[model samples]
Target: MECFRIDESGYTGFDLLNRDQRFQGATAIAIDDEEAARLIREYFPRLQAGELKYRALSRRPGNHPRLLALLAELLRAHKSVTYVCDKRFLLILMFCDYAVEPYYYERGCNFYEDGQNYGMASLLATAGPTLLGKSEFEAMLAAFQRATKEKTPAALKDLVRAAQKTKWRELPEAIGPLAQYAAPECLSAIATEGVTTDAALVVLQSLITRMEVMSDGPYRVEHDQSKNLATYHDLLCRFIGHEEEIELRQSEIASFKFPLKLTEVVQVDSKASPAVQLADVMIGAALEAANVMTGLRADGLDPEKLMPLYAEDQFIHLIPSVDFAEQKQFRRGTQAAEVIDYFAANFGPKK
Candidate 1:
C-alpha cells in the first residue's frame, strides 16, 4: 500500500568528459495516496503557484528562509532517499566497465595497478558503438585519438580504432536488439542521463529493500515522466530483477535484503503529482547542500554542519561514487575531508 514518486534535477550534460558539469541527482518520496494528498494540501498554498521546484522555491534570495524550512521538514520525515553524484565518480563507471570485464580481470583493482589503467575510453571503445552508433562513435573515437596519441591511461587507442570500424557483423547477438533500438540522441544521453537514471535505480533498490522489512502486501511507484528517465527506469526494473525477488549471483545490487515487492510503476507529470513535487524539493535540497560545500567557489560552507540541519542521523548523502558512501562516522573538520580524500588518493584523482 506504499506509493513512491520520483523527481530529479541539476543535470545539464550527459557527456561523461564534461567534468565541469554540475551535480546530478534523483530523489524519491514514498507515501500512500492519503498522505500524498495531505502533504499537497498543506504545502501547495505556500509554494509558488506554478511548480513546486527546489530551484525556484529554494534558490531565490527572498525564498531562502522558506526553502530552509522545507529542507528542515524533509529531514524530519523518513520517507525520502537521495543520490547526489560527483561528476568525476560517475564518469569512472565507464572505467569500471573496463576493469571488471573478462578480458581485463587481471588489471582490475589490485596491489600494483590500483585500477588506474581502466579508463572510460576502454568501455566506450568496446561498448560505445552499441549506444552511440557508427558515425557518432567514430567521431567520439576521433576526439580520443587526438587527446591520447601516445599516452592513453587504459591503452584505449586500439579499442577506439576498433570501435570506428564496428559493424553489425562484428557485434554479438546479445547486442542486436540494442543496436536496432539505439539512436544518435539516446547514445548521447547515456552519460548525463545515466547518472540520474542509475542513481534512481539504486534508490529504488534500497527503498524497496527497506520497505520489505517495514511493510507487507504490494507497492506502487509513480514518477514524474521524462521519456528518457522513464525509459531507463523501466528498462532496469524489467531486465535486472523483481523488486522483491532477485537471483543472488546475477544481482546488480549485492545487498538485496528483500525490497518490498513492487506491483506497478506509473509515470505522471509533476504538476499533477504531489509526491513527485515533494521529491523534487528533497532532491533539490540534497544536491544544493553538496553544491554549496563543494561547488560554488564563493559558498565555502562547512560540510559537517550540513548533516545536522536534517533529522538526527538522516540527511542528504553527497556521494562521489556509484556506491553510496557510509557517512555515520562523518565527523566535522578533517574527518569530513577524509571521506573524499580517501577515494581521491586511491581512486581516480579529482578530474
Candidate 2:
C-alpha cells in the first residue's frame, strides 16, 4: 500500500499566544524509504547516524545551504504538501467562531459562510493591540484560551467578563457592534462539548485532504511520534471514509463530507524512518520561511526564495487574511489596514 510520511514543527499545544513559537506547520511527503535515504545521504553527508532534526541542524554553521538544497531537491523530486498556521491569528479565529459568531447565528446569520468571521478576526489580530492596549488584548485572548481548555461555567463567565470590560466606547465604530453582541451564552454553548484550538489538527486535516486529492487510491500515513499522537490518531479516525458533522449548541455548525482516501494513521520513530526525517526537514523549512516572512527570525534562509521548486498547490497556509485594505478611516482601522497590507505583500500564495 502507498504510504506518506508526516512531521510537524512549532507545536505549543493550544497556547496560541506563545511568545517564542508563533507558527505551527506540518508536512507530508510521498517519497519511498529508499529514495529518501539516498537523498539524505547525498545532501546531508555530515549526519552519520541519528535522525535529521532541522532545529539542531539549523543552529550549526554552513548547514543553511545544505538544508535549502535538500528542500529544493525534495520539492523537485517528490509529491509533498505543507500547511502552516499562524497560532495567534488562529486564536483570533477561534474567538470569532466561538465567542462572536454564535450570537449572529442565533439571529439567522452565518459569519463563517459569509466570510465575516475572517474579516473580524483580521481586524482584531491586526489592530486590537493599538485600540485595546497590547496587554489588555493579550489578556483577553489568554482568558479565552484558558476558558477553552477548562470548559467550566466559571471559565466561560470569565471570558464573557473580559469582553464586557473592554473599553469599546472609545474604540472604532466597527468594533462597537461586536462588543455589544459579545454573548456569554455563545461561549457557554461552545464549551459544552469542549473547544479545541489545536493548530496541529488543522494542519493535519488540510494536509490529509490535499494528499487524498493527490493520491490515486487509499493511502496510509506514518507520522513522527509526538505527545499528541493519540489525539492525531483519533482525529484521523473521525473523518476517514465517513462524513463528520461538528455541532455547536445542538446546531449543525460545520460538516466534513469529503471521502477520505486515508487507510491508517500511525506514529513512527523518525530515527528509523528516512521518509519521516525528510518530512521533518520540509516542515522545518516551511516554518522557517514563514518566520522570515513575518520578521520573527532574521538569520535563517528564506525558503520563499525557493517557491519555484514546488507546484502552486503544494503548500496550504492557514494564516490571517490580508484583504482588509479598505477598512474604515478610524485610527485602529487604519492601523489594521497597514498591517494587513504588509502581510498581504510579504507572505501568501505566490502567483
Candidate 3:
C-alpha cells in the first residue's frame, strides 16, 4: 500500500486566535524511501547527517534558492499536497457553525443549506475585527475559546455575554443576529460533545480526503511525531467507517460526516524519516508564503518571488472566499465596504 508522509507547521493547538502564529499548515508527500533520501542528499547535502528543518535553513541567507529548488524537485518527483488554515478565519467559521447556526437551526432554519453560513462567516471574518474593534473582537474569540476549552455553563455564559456586548448594530445584517441569540446551550453542546476546533485535524481531514481520491485503494500515513498523536490516532479510527451524531441542541441532532479512507496512521521521528522531513520543509515554506501574502508576517521574503514555486493545486486553504454578488451587496460608503476592502486588499488572485 502507498504511504504518505505528513508534517505540520504553526501548530498552536485549538487556539485559532493566536496572534503570533496566525496560520497553520500541513503537508503530505507520497514518495519512495530511496527517492526521498536521494533528493535530500542532492539538494540538502549538509543536512545528510542531521534532520532537515525548514526554520533553521530558512534563517540563513542564500538558502532560499536551495529550499525552493528542493521543493520544486520534490513536487516534480512526488505527489504532494499542503493544507493551510487562516486560524482567525477558522474561529469565525466555528462561531458561525457552532454558535450561530445551531441557534437558527433550533428555530427551524437551515443556516447551511443555501451557503448562507459561508457568506456570513466571510463577512464576520473580514469586517468583524474592524467594526467590533480589535479588543472586542479578540475578547469575543477568547470567550468562545474558553467556553470550548473549559466546557462549563459558566464559560458558555461568558461567551454569550461577550456576544451580547458586541456592537452588532454597526455591522452587517447577517452578523447582527449572532450577538442577540447565540445560544449558550448550543455552544455548551459542542464542548460537551468534545468537538475540537483544531486546525491540524482540519488539515489532516482535507489531506486524507485528497489522498483517498488520489489512491486506488487503502493507503497508510506516516506523520511526524507530535504531542497530539493519540488524538490523531483516535480520530483516524473514527474515520474508518464510523458514524456518530452531534447534539447541536436539545431538539437538533446533526449527523457527523466522516469522509475518510485509510489503513493505518503512524507517527515517526522527523530525523528518521526523510519523507517527513521533506513534508516539514514543504509545510513551513507554504505557511510562510501564505503569511507573507496575507500580511500576517514580515519575514523579508517577497511572496511574489515564491509564487511560481507555490503551485495552486499543491495547496488547500480553509480561508473563505466571498463571491462577487456578496461583494456588491456592500455599498460604497457603508460599513460593509470594510469587508469588501479587506478582501480586495488581502485576498483574491495574487499578481
Candidate 4:
C-alpha cells in the first residue's frame, strides 16, 4: 500500500497528497480539468507515492477487506468536510456509518451489504459512540411513555418522562416534559442491556425496522428484492402489529417539492439536535443517505450500493458523475473563501 499523487491544476508535488488536502472524509485534488486528466492518465504514479492504510483497533475482529476497501474509497471521495479524530482514523471512518446505527454490534462488521442483519446498532459500540437512530429512538420514547403509564422504574426513560406520563393519547404531550430525562448513561445502559419489558423490547425492534425504511433513501441501499421483501414484510408485520396486506401504491407516494432542480443537489438541515442528528445518522447514516436515495429514485437505478452518511462524520458524498463539483465551483453567493479570510482578519488564529 503505497502513497498516491495527483498533480492536477497548480497543485503539484507532494502537496497534492498533503494531509491538509484531505478534508472531512474526502480527498481533494489540486488541479483543473487538464491536470485532472494528466493525473488520471498516470494514476499509478500516485499510488506509488501513498499507501492505502488500514489500522483496525477494536476489541472485536477487523472488518472484511472487500467491504473495508469500498468504504475507504467512499471516505476518500467524501472526505472534504469530514474529519477523522482517532488513531485508526481510516479504519474507524469506514465503520462510522454502521457504528451509529442500532443493533450494529449483533450483526458484526459486515452488515451494510445485507439489510437483513438484526443487531447493527449493538455492534457499533465496539467502535465508539457517534450516531443515534431516530425512528428507533422515537419508538423507544413511545415505550418510555408506556412504561410511565405502567409505573415502571424511572431509569428506563428517554429524559421526557414528565410529559410522557400524561393521559394524552397523542405522543407529543407525553414526550415534551420527558425530553430532559434522556441521559447518555441511561441510553448506554439500554444499548448494552437488552430490554426486559415487552413494551420496551417491541420499541427496540421497531427502531431497527424504521432504520431499514429510512435507509432506503434514493442513492442509499434498498435491500428490498423479492427475497429481501419477504424478510422485510415479516419485519413490518411484526413492527406494525398485525399483518394487513401491504402493497406499493406508487400514486399514493406523492412527490415532494424540490428546493433545487432535478439536475441540482441541495443540502438541507433537518434542524435536528445533536442527539436527534445522531439518531438519524445511526438510522440512515447522514443527510447524504437521504440525498442519494432521492437522487437515485429520481433516475432509474437500484440504490442498495449507496452508503449511509452520518452527520457528525461531516462530509457530503457525491458520485463522481454528479454536478456537485460544478455547483461548488460556482458558489459565489454563499459564505465561501472570502468569508474565511474576513474571519481570520478579525479574530486572528487561535494559536
Candidate 5:
C-alpha cells in the first residue's frame, strides 16, 4: 500500500549491435542495473498517480537478486557491444495498474494514442502555477534588451509580441513520408519535462477555452428553497440534545424504518401561517405531550401519547412508552414535537 513519487533522470544505454547492424536497420538495446534503477525513479510518480503498488528495487537494491542476475546476464552477453536502451520508453511503465494486471514483466506492447494521449506537460498545464518556465520579469528584461539593440525602442505590447513569436521556434520539424505531420499547434518544447507533444496541446487548448469564458463577479439565486431544510434541521438539533441522532430525509431516500424506542409523529399548527411554514408543527405537539407522559405534569400534555398523530405504519415507531428510563431516553424525541408545536402555535395559521 506504500506510494512513491519518482524522478526519472540520469540513465544511459549501450547498443549490442555494431554500426554495421544499425545501417541495415537492426539495433538491440539493453539496460544495466543502474539504468533500471533510474527507470524506476522516472516512472514512480506516474505510478502513484495511477494508484499502483510495487516494491521498489532501489529501496532494497541489495535484495533484488533476480533483477541483478538478469542485468548481469545481459551485460555479459553484450560485453563490448552497445544498445540504445531508451528510458523515455520506460515512462509508460509507471502506469501499470497492479490490481487489474499483476504480471508487469510479461505485459505485451503498451499502446499509445496520438489524440487521447496524456503526459506530464498536460498534467502540469491543467494544474500548474501562475508562472511557467522563464520568469515573466526576465522575459520582459530580455525583450527590452533586444529591442534596445535593434534601435527601435519597442512598446510594451510589441515586446510581448516578440516573446510569443520566439516560442514558435520550438516546434519539431516534419520528416520522412509523414513530412506533413508538422502541425501548426505542435509543441516542440514546454515548461515541464517528460510530457508528450499531444499532452501539451491539450493543456494549451484548455487554457484558451478557460480564458474565453472567464467570470467577473459572484451570483446568487433569489428563490432557493434548499436553505429552508437546513434551518429546520438546525431547529431540531437545538430542541433535542441528540443532534447527531436526528436523520434528515431527502426526496429520494424518504422512507426508512425507526427503532422500537422511536416513532414517527407530528406537531399540530395553531397559529397564523400553517400552509407555508417550513418546519413541521405536528412533531412539536408530540414533544410537548411526551413531557406530560413522563409524569412531569407540565400542562398534562403527553408527548408519547401524541405519537399516533404522525405514525403512518405500525412497525415505524416514533414515540417511547412512559417508563422512567424510556422517558429519559426518548426526551429528545418528545422535545422535538414540543419545539415544533410551540413555534407553530405562535406563528402558524389559525386552526
Candidate 6:
C-alpha cells in the first residue's frame, strides 16, 4: 500500500480571517519508509540547534538554502501536492454575498455567537501587513488583541456584536474607501452552513485534487496533529466513510480492514514522522513563493529573494521539470470542481 504524509502552516480555525493572518497552506508528500529514514539521517546533523522542523528553522537566514534543497529533493524524488492559500482572497470568496436560506443565515450567526467562526482572524491577517504604520489598523489590532483573549463563545459573540457599535479609528488616507469595511461584521460573517461549506471547499478541493492526481489506491494520509483541527479531521473522515479516531500509524489503519483505495486519514506528531516534518519545510518556502505567485507581494517586496531558495543548482535542479508529465492529470471531484470554478472566478493564484 502507498503512503503519504501531510503538514500544515498557519491556523485554519477562528484564526483563518485575522488581519495578521499568515499564509495558510497544506503540503502532501508521497515518500517511502526508506527515503524517509534517509532524509532524517542526512539532514539531522545539519539541522540547527533547537530546530524542530521547517517552521522554526526556516525563519532564520542561514536555513533558507537547506529548506529549498529539501523541497527540491521532494519534488524530484517523490510525488507531491502543495496548496498555499491567500486567505485574503479566500475571504472574498467566502463572503461574496450570495443569496442564502434563512437557516443558512442563522447557522452563520450561530457559529459567530458560538465562537466557531475564524473569518476575523483571516481578515485581520490579510489587512495587517499593509496597514503596518497606520492608525485604524492599530485600533483593529487592539481589538484583535482583546478579542483573542475572549475564551467563551458568548464573549466572542459580544465582540462580534460590538463591531458596528464601537467607534473605530480613522483609516489611513492611502487605504481609501476600502477601509470602510472595518466593521466587525465586514471582517467575517458569523458562518452559516453555507459559509462553512464555502470555507471548507478550498481545503477539501486541494486534497481531493491531489488524490486524483496521484490516482486511486488504498492510500493512507498522515497529517500533523493539532487539537483545534479536530473538526477538520472529522470532515475528512466523513468524506472517506472512515469513522475511526486518529490512529497516527499505518499499521493501525491496516488492522481495521479499511480499503486501500479509499484514504484512511490520521494525524500524528510531526516529531514522530519525518515526512510530516518535511512537508512543514516545503510549505514554509511555498508560502513566500505563493506571495510571489499571487500579486500580494508584487509591489511590496522583492520576491526574487525566494529565487535562490530554489536556485537551479542548489535545489530547483533536484526537482524534476517534467514539462509534459501527465502526473498531474487526475481530475477533481464535483465539489472540488465547483470550488475551482469559484476560485477561478475570484483571484485564484498562479500555479
Q: Of the candidates shown, which would achieve the greatest TM-score relative to the real structure?
A: 2
lDDT of 3 by residue, 247-278 (tens): 11110111122334477787788788888888
Q: Per-candidate RMSD vs. true structure?
A: 12.7, 8.6, 9.2, 22.7, 34.9, 12.1
lDDT of the candidates, in the order given: 0.46, 0.70, 0.68, 0.26, 0.24, 0.46
Error of 6 at 291 (Å): 5.3
Best by lDDT: 2
Give candidate 2's error at residue 350 in angstroms. Answer: 40
Of the two candidates 1 and 5, the one with more favorable lDDT, higher being better, is 1
- The estimated TM-scores of all candidates read 0.57, 0.83, 0.82, 0.18, 0.15, 0.55
lDDT of 4 by residue, 1-351 (tens): 111111011111111112322211212111133332332234223332122222211111332333334333434442112211111122222222212222333335332322211122222223122223434343443453344234345634433443233332332211222343343433442333222221112222222322323222321111112331233333333333322332221111111121111121112222311211212222222222333354522321123543432233333232111233444333323321222223223222123
Worst 10 residues of 2 by lDDT: 247-256
Q: How accurate is candidate 4 locally (lDDT)?
A: 0.26
Tens digits of lDDT, candidate 1, 174-253 = 22222343322223222221222133433344444444433456666777777646643564355334343322211222
Local distance difference test, candidate 1: 0.46
Please state the error at residue 314 of candidate 1 in Å: 4.8
Candidate 2 ranges with C-alpha deviation above 4 Å: 170-184, 241-256, 324-351
Better of 2 and 6 by lDDT: 2
Better of 1 and 4 by lDDT: 1
What's the true lDDT of residue 133 in model 5? 31
Where does model 5 exceed 4 Å of error?
1-272, 276-280, 302-311, 314-351
> Compared to the true structure, candidate 2 yields what TM-score?
0.83
* Number of the candidate with higher TM-score, 1 or 5: 1
lDDT of 3: 0.68
